[model samples]
Each structure stands twice: as structure tokens, then as C-alpha cells.
Target chain A: MIHPSAKIGKNVVLGQSVVIEENAEIGDDAEIGHHVIIKKDTKIGNRVKVGDLSVLGKTTSKNKKMARKPGAALTPLVIEDDVRIGCNTVLYRNLLLKQGAFVGDLSSIREKVTVGEDSIIGRNVIVETNTVIGSRVTVQTGCYVTADMIIEDDVFLGPCVSTSNDKYMGEGNYPYQGPIIKKGAKVGNNATLLPGITIGEKAIIGAGATVTKDVEAGKTAVGNPARVIK
Target chain B: MIHPSAKIGKNVVLGQSVVIEENAEIGDDAEIGHHVIIKKDTKIGNRVKVGDLSVLGKTTSKNKKMARKPGAALTPLVIEDDVRIGCNTVLYRNLLLKQGAFVGDLSSIREKVTVGEDSIIGRNVIVETNTVIGSRVTVQTGCYVTADMIIEDDVFLGPCVSTSNDKYMGEGNYPYQGPIIKKGAKVGNNATLLPGITIGEKAIIGAGATVTKDVEAGKTAVGNPARVIK
Candidate 1:
């Protein structure tokens, strides 16, 4: 059901059973797959390709026990030109995807997040709320980007990397703050980054390492409670 | 689009845009959500609840680089009574889910897999092909259960646990063999289980541990290349 107030641009292709809510705007040459849902007031730019069953501009579901509280009203989600969204992906409201951003299958991007241009979020990745990922970043399959995190430009995160934002695991004493991965930092597969740490510029974290502290610039860290290797 | 050959039992609730292919069977009191696709010859038992955008009895997608090859024709998927499947989940063909099993949202279960009674597969979990998850097992959120694995009854895997089946990734030289987690074993959050290891009964793997070898029965393992603790 396309709402009468929704604006569809020239050459837009909508598949079967697509729901475009009120005031949603789809730019020229946009391709929306079957069963896609675009919520109210979402703005999708030209040449965006949304795969089947993708849900865009969805509202957040929060419980009372959560430390962070959302505001009364959130801004609409914005998608720039040449963005590619895979099947069964869920992108929440108040998010921004710059040009050429790619979200893979079964991924979830929460609200208040911004993904810069040419960024790649691989399959089954979970990017939590209030995170900022810079351009040319590559987050591989099954990685978890925690809430309130900052990933700078040219960062590479391998598959199954787990980032934590809470040190106390819901005790609510410590404030939630995920790691700050600086430019050109590379985290290997199955690595764990503890809360509130900083991965310095061009640093490398080895596979299966558990990082508990800040890593120095241009250094390599490996093992549990990761230590710098010469 | 319900096919003419599909068999729907009494009091089954189907949502909008649901697609049931030929020879598919839905038992009594089953609740199928919107945009759910049940492929040909799939069988869903009584009181099953399938959430929106789910795909059941899907075929496997294999490239030439994959080590294992699927058979010419696979059998239908079977879900027993009272099973619950969450939104955006995908279950491949030739699989079986016993009574009262729960598959959380955005999960993916590959073909030739068997999940025993009352097993809980949490959100964004991936169970690869040829895996056998026994009765009452609990695999927590964002876990990766590798192919050819054997997880026995009552095993508890915490959040973000990663398992591997290949010694050399994508080499195709080594035989794929994932970890064999024995009955009632408990693996903590962010743990990494290396290929072909055996986790003995009631063993405990500490959080953020990288397990390299077999863990003894009723023991506790911690740290990278995890050693037995007192």
C-alpha cells in the first residue's frame, strides 16, 4: 500500500506488497524489492537498491531498564545515492547512510547511527544505536558494533568481532561507552574489545585476542588481555 | 499465494502476503506471520508460531569454492509441535526442529541440521550445515555454530561465542570438524572454540577465553589458549 502522500520519483521500481508510508520520498531509479517497508517521512536518494523483506526507518524498541532514554520525537532516516541494502535487513529510524554504503543480509542497524560513504557492513552484523562509522570502513560478517561507539575511516573489522559497551553487564553503575577505533585500525576475527578502550591509529589486533586496554598507534596487540608485540 | 496442493489444518492463522508452496502442510492452531514463505513439501506441526519475513525450507547456496557439496535432491524440513520461529529467520531444507524449540529473530539454520526438543537458538545465531543440537540446549545471541558440529543435551553457550570447523580457513585441504560440546557444558560469553576440540561434560569455559585444546570433564578453563583453573 503506497500512501497518497508518499512521493515516488521517476523510474522507481517497487515490487509486490511494498508499503510506503505517508510522506516517504523515493528518488529516481530506486529499486525496492518485495515486502519492503518504508516508514513515514523517510528520504531515500537516487539509485538505492533495497532487497526483499528489508525494513527501513523502523522505530526503536526499548525497555525501562535501559540506561539510555530516547527523546520524544526522532528525525526520519536518510539514505543517500547508490546505497545497497540486502535482504531481511532492518534499519532503524533517525539513521543516516551516506552514498555507496552497503548493508548485507540479515543485518540490523539501530537508531541515531551514521554510516559514512563507501562503508561496508557485512552479513549478520549488528550495529547498535548512536554509533558513528566513517568512510571506507569494512565490518565483516557477524561482527557486533556496540552502542555509542566511534569507528574512524579506513578501519577493518574481521568476522565475529565482538565489541562491548557495558563493563558491568547491566549493573548500570558504569556508563556505557564502546571502543574508539581510530583510522586504519584492523581487528582480526573473533577478537573481543572491552568497554571504554581506544584502538589507536593503524593498530592491529590479532585473532582471538581479548583487548582490555588502549592499544598504541601503529602497534600490534595479541592474546588475552592483549599486550603489544614488537 | 497459497498453492492448491497445500494442506492447512483447522484454526491456522495466516497473515498477509504469506506464501505456502505446493505440498506444504500447516498443522492446527499455527500462527504464520506476514510475508512468511514456506517452500514446497515443508511440514509445520500444531501450535507453531512463525514470525514475519521468515523463510522456511530454503535451498542451500553453494559456490564452487565450498568444500562440501549438497545432494541432488534434499528432503523437506520438519517442525514438530509448539515450535516458535522469529522474524527474518531462515531455515534450509532437510532440517528438523523437535517440539517446543525456539529460534530467535534473524537466525539462520542450514540444511541437514537437527535441533532437538526445546532447544533455544537466540537472535542472530548461525547454525551451519550437518549440525546436531541436542535437547534443551541454549545457544545465546550472536553465536556462530560451525558446520559438522555435535552439541549434546542441556549445553549452554553464552552470547557471541564463535566456533570453527576449519584448521586453515578456506584452504579446503583439512577435513572440517567443529567442536564437540558434551552434555551440560557451559561456555561463557565471547569464547572462541577452535576446530575439532572436545568440551567435556559440565565443563566451564570462561568469558573471552580462546580454547585451543580439549577441556576436561567438570573443569574450568580460562584465558587465551585456555588452561584448566581450580
Candidate 2:
């Protein structure tokens, strides 16, 4: 049941049992699939396609103190024009998925995150809060994009990539921080990026590597500790 | 809508908008959550709990030729007594989740799989086709249990554990055979196990390790190619 306050534009196709809450706005030509839930205050742009069972504008109670801020619902979810969200994806509040961005099935994009235009967040991926992904970035299936990370333009992350946000692990509820994946960098499948490191421009991290430190520009890093091979 | 052929036992509590397909049976005192879909030939045992949006008896088209085998529906999805299926989970047909088994949210278990009694399949975990998990096993969040794998009793797999099939890396589709995690083995977070390798009884695989070879019984392995540390 769509609330009386929802502003659904022309040619919007809502599948079986799509729920649009109060104050939600769906742009023209948007297709929301079966069992989808658009929470209160979500703003979906034109030509957007949200697949079956996707949920947008999920609450950020896990953020603890950040969620208790005054007027939390005032900041709505912004899914820009031509974005494509796959089946069973979940998006939290205050995220901006820019033009032509594609999020794959079963992925989770948490709050305060920005998915750049033409970027691909593939199937089963997780982009935590406070992260920024640049244009045309391809984070493949099952990759875990840690919080507070910056993935620059033209980056390619292969399947099952893992990233960490804390140095001493989560012993102290420490602030999140992670590696900066520079422009045109390529991280191979199943690579693990340690906290606070940086992958230089055009660098390549081989598959199954555990990156311990920073990699220089135009270098190829492989194996555990991930030293530059070239 | 409950199909005419579906047998819903007394005291079964189905939440709003639950769909029970043809030949599906929900045993006594089973609780099904809202928007849950139980497909054809599914059998939910007594006291079973299925969370919201979960789908049971999904087709095994991804199993390729195996899906066309005779009597596919005859080996119906069986959730034994006191089983728990978490939210957004997808369980394929011909799988048997034994009594007291608990599957966490967003997990996917494919066809012909048998999860033994009291096993825990954690959140976001994917257990591929034809795998057998023994009793009291704990496969934590984000663990990928590949096809044709065997995880024996008392095995513990930590978060983000990745297991691969095909030693030649899908060169021939390779028949999909992965490691056998023996009894009482413990695999730490983000560890990758190579194809056909056996994790011996009481063995330990450390975090971020890329295991190329098998670890002997009572051994502790760490690092890339995962040599014995203890």
C-alpha cells in the first residue's frame, strides 16, 4: 500500500506488493519489482530500476550515536537518474547512487555512502557507510567495501575481495579507516586489503594476496604482505 | 495464497502475505514470516521457523544438467523438526536441513545439500550444490562453501572464509570439487581453501591464509600456501 503522500510520477511500474511509505517520491519510468519496500523520505530518480525484494532507506540504528541526530528522516535516500538496483539489495538512508550506477543482487549499501555514476557494485557486495566510490569503478561479486574508504575512478575490484577498516581490529569501537584504491587500480579476486594502506594509480593486486602495506604506481603486488613484484 | 494441495498442519502461524505452493506441507506449530514463499514439494517439519521474505524449494537450474534428473521434485526440500531459516534466505530443492539446524539471514543453500542437526549456517553464507555439512558445524558470516564440498562434524568456519572448487580454475568446469573440512577443524576469518585439499581433524587455518596444501591432523597453518606453523 502506497501512502497518500507518496509522489509517484508517470509511467512508474510497481510490481506486486510494492510498498512506498509516506513522503516517498518516485520519478517517471521507474520500475520497482515485487515485494520492494521504499521507506519514508526516499527519492528515486527517473528511469531507475529496483529489482525484486529490494529495500531502500533502511534505518541506521547500528550507527548508534549517528542515528540519534535530530531530524534524521530529513535526509532522504537519493537514487539518481538511470540507476539499476538488482534483486534483494538493501540500501540505507542518506546514500546517493548517482547516474547510471548499477548495484547487483543481494548487495548492501549502508548509510552516508556515495556510489559514483556508472559504477558497478556487483552481486553480494557490501559497501559500508562513509565510503565514496568514484565513477566507473567495478567492485565485483562478494567484495566487502569497508567503511571510510575511497575508491577512485576506473578501479576494478574482482570477486570476493576483502577490506579491513581497523588496525588493531575492533577491540575498542575505533573509528573506521581503510585503504585508498587509487584511480585505475585493479585488485584481483580474493585479495585482502589491510587497514590504512593505499593502492597507487594503475597498480595491480594479484588474486589471493593479503596487502599489508602501500603499493607504488604502476606496480604489481602479489602474495601475502603484498610486496611489489613489478 | 495457499495452494489446494498444500497441507498446513494445525497451529501453524503464517504471517501476512505468505505463499504456500502446490504439495507444500507445513508441520504443526510452524511459524512462517511475512512475504515468505514456500514453493512446490517443500516440507517444513514441526516447530520450524522461517523468517520474512525467505524462499524455500527454489529451482536448481544453476546445477546445470543435474537439474534435469528424474524425480527431482520427489526429493523434496525437507526442513526437519525445530529448524530455523532466517530472513531473505533461499533454499533450493532436494536439500535436507536436519533437526535443530539454524540458518542465518541472507544465506543461500543450493540443491542436494544436507545440513546435519544443530549446524549453523551464518549470515550471507553461500553453500553450493551437493555439499554435506555434519552436526554441530558453525559456518560463520560470508563463508562461501563451494559445490561438492564436505564439512564434517564440529567444524568451525569464521567470517569471510572462501572455499574454491576446480583446481584448474574452471578450465573444464572441473566437476566442482572442493576441500573436505574434517572433524573439529577451525578455519579463521578470510581464509581461502584450495580445491581438493583436506583440512585434517582438529586442524586450524589462521586468518587471511591462502591454503594451497592440506594441513595434517592437530596442525596449525598460516600464511599464503599455508605452511604448518604448529
Candidate 3:
């Protein structure tokens, strides 16, 4: 059932028993699976295949400890053209999946996470809060990307890769810093990149490597306190 | 439409245009979302809420390198009674969500994971393969539990927390040992628990802490190479 305030483009195929909430927008030739929930202020682009049981744009207040006020401005989730969001994937508010980005099944993109154009997020990837993923990046299955990390363009994150963002973690308020991964870098499977470390462009982080320092461009690093191997 | 191969119990109230796939078993009074894909051999228990765009027992075999064989036997997903699975949550093959377990919206439980009874897994939590989460545990929002982790009962994992399973993290094969979090432990927000460590019972890991060694019971730990403060 499309709500009266919902905007539907021409030739949009909504499967039987679909529920579109108020102020949602579905573009032309979009196929919405059965029982999907497109909540308020969400925009679905043309020709997108939104699989069943997926919920988009469910708004909630940010963590009270991180916010200036109890209630803040609510932003909508925007999905650009030619994006194929797989089954059971959820995109919350303030998420923008640029054109041709493919989020595999069961992937979750948190708020303020911008997946650049043509990036591929594999299945079951948990992209934590405020991480910016660059265009044409490939994050394989089951990667845990912690908050405030920046993955630049053409980066390859292997399956089950891990990244951290805080160096001296404490309970009370602490200074916040962001980690940067430069373009064309490759982080191997199950690798652990520590907080505030930068991986230069085209650097290769070996599988299972624990990187604690910045790797120069085109170098290879590995180990517990990862040292440059090449 | 319940397939003939599907076994549904009495008093089940399926909403309009619900689709149950082959060999799926639904218990009494269960409410399945419309267009939800309860795939083959899934067992959903009584009074469960399988929300919209949510897919149960949908396993992807593309990651064949991680399996023992190229393609091993496909096991069923079992959900016990009173499980409240929210929108777009996905349980892959051989997952067992024990009685009274609550999986928040957009979470993903990968293959062979067991979520213990009455455990509350918050929004966007991703439990990777073979992780065993104990009863009454609470994994808060955006936490990533890596493979083969043993989280005991009454454990509290905060937002954006992560655990590693591999030490060297080499490719093609995962070679690192898993970590164990003992009962009544609390891992704080944005914390990182390295592999092969054991967090003792009643220990409190501070927010943004990076735990490296085995923590003693009732201690509070924090820092880059986390040390016990109390």
C-alpha cells in the first residue's frame, strides 16, 4: 500500500502487500519487494532493486552523549541511480549510496556513512558510525570498520578485516581523531589497523597484519606492531 | 503462500501476501512480514516477529574459500520461542537464536553463530562466523563480533566495539586464536579486544579502550595497549 503522501514514479513495480510510508519517493522502474518498509523522507532511485524485508530511513535520535541536544534535525537517506541494494540490507538516516554502488545482502550502513560512487560493500559488512568510504572501493565480507575511519578510492578491504579509531580509549569524554587510508591501498583478510594510522596510496597491508604506524606509499607492512617489510 | 513442503504450526497469523519457502517451519502465532523470505529448512518458533525485508536462512556460498569444502552441507537456521527479530535482520545457515533472543533492526548473524537465550543484540550488530554469544548478553549498537569469539553470559558490548580472531591474519587461511569474554563483563563503546585474550568475569573495559592482555576479574582497563587501572 502506497501512502497518499508517497511519491511514485511511472512504471514502478511494487510487489503485493508492500507498505510505503509517508513522504517516501520511489523512482521509475524500481522493484520493491513484498513487505518492505520504506519509511518517511527516504528516496529510492530509478531501477533499484530493493529486496524483501529491508527497511530504509528509520529515524532515531543520535546518542544523547554525542549530541548537543536531545533532538536534532532529521535527515533523509538518499540512494542515487543504478544502486542495487541486496536482500535484507538496511540504510538508516543520513546515508548516501552514490551511483552504481552495490551493497550486498545483510550489509548495514550506519548514519553519516557516505559510500562513494561504484563502491562495493560485501555481505554482512558492518560500517560503523561516521566512516567515509571512497569511490570504487571493495570491502569484502564480514569486515568491521570502526567509527571515524576514512577509506580512500580503490581500496580493497579483504574479508573479516578490522580497523580501530581510538588510541587511548576511556569511559569519560576523550578527544576524537579520524584514521585515513589513502587511495589504491589493500588491507588483507583479518588485518587490524590501529587508530590514527595512515596507509599511504598503493600500500599493501599483509593479511592478519596489525598496523600501528603510517605506511609509506607502495610499501608492504606486517606484524603485531606492524613494521614495513618493503 | 506457504509452500506445501513447509510445516506451519497452529494459530499462526501470517499477514497478507506472505511467502514461506520450501521446508520452512513456523510455530504457533508467529507473525511473518509480507514478502519475507523464509528460505529452505528454517525453523521459526512461536510468537516471533520476522520483520519486513528480513530473510531467514539465506546463506551465500560465494565465500567458498572460508568453508572446509568448496561447498559444505547447508544447515538450517533455528529460532526458538519469543525471538523478536527486527526489520532486515538476516540469519544465515546454521544460526541458532535461542529462546527470548532479541535481534535489533538491521543486524546480521553470520553462519554457525549461536545467540544465547534472552540476549539483546542492538541495531547494526554483526556477529561473524562461529561466534558463540552467551545468554542474557547485550551487544550494543554497531558492534562487530569477529569469528570464533566466545562471549559468556551477562556480557555487555558497547557501540562500535570490535574483536579480532586472527593474529597474523594471513590470506586463504585464518590462523589466529579466538578470544573469550567471561561472564558479567562489560566492554565499553569503541573498544577493541585483540585476539587470544581472555577478559575475566565482572571486568569493565573502558570506552575506546584497546585491550591487549588477559584482564583479571573486577578490574577496569583502558589505553592503547590496555592496562588494568583498578
- CA RMSD (A), model 1: 5.5
Q: How would you encode candidate 1's per-residue C-alpha lDDT over B1-230 as one tens digit per residue?
A: 99999999999999678999999999999999777999999999999998778999998887887767668798999999988887788999999999988887788999889998888887789999989999988886788899999999988886688899999998888989999999989886698899999999988887698899999999999897799986
lDDT tens per residue, model 2, A33-89:
668999999999998988668899998764664522444453789999988886678
Sort by lDDT, top down from the best: 1, 2, 3
Highest-TM-score candidate: 1
Ranking by DockQ: 1, 2, 3
Task: Name every residue pair that clashes in candidate 1.
Answer: none
Per-model DockQ: 0.16, 0.14, 0.12
Candidate 3: which stretches are off by over 4 Å?
A: A1-85, A90-102, A106-120, A123-198, A201-215, A218-230, B61-71, B173-176
Answer with 1 or 3, whichever has the higher TM-score: 1
Best-performing candidate as measured by lDDT? 1
Residues B142-204, candidate 3: write the lDDT tens digits: 777877789999999889776766654323365655679999999888776777899999999
Give lDDT tens digits, candidate 2, residues B158-182.
9988876655432355665778999
- Chain A TM-score across all models, in listed order: 0.98, 0.94, 0.92
TM-score of each: 0.72, 0.71, 0.64
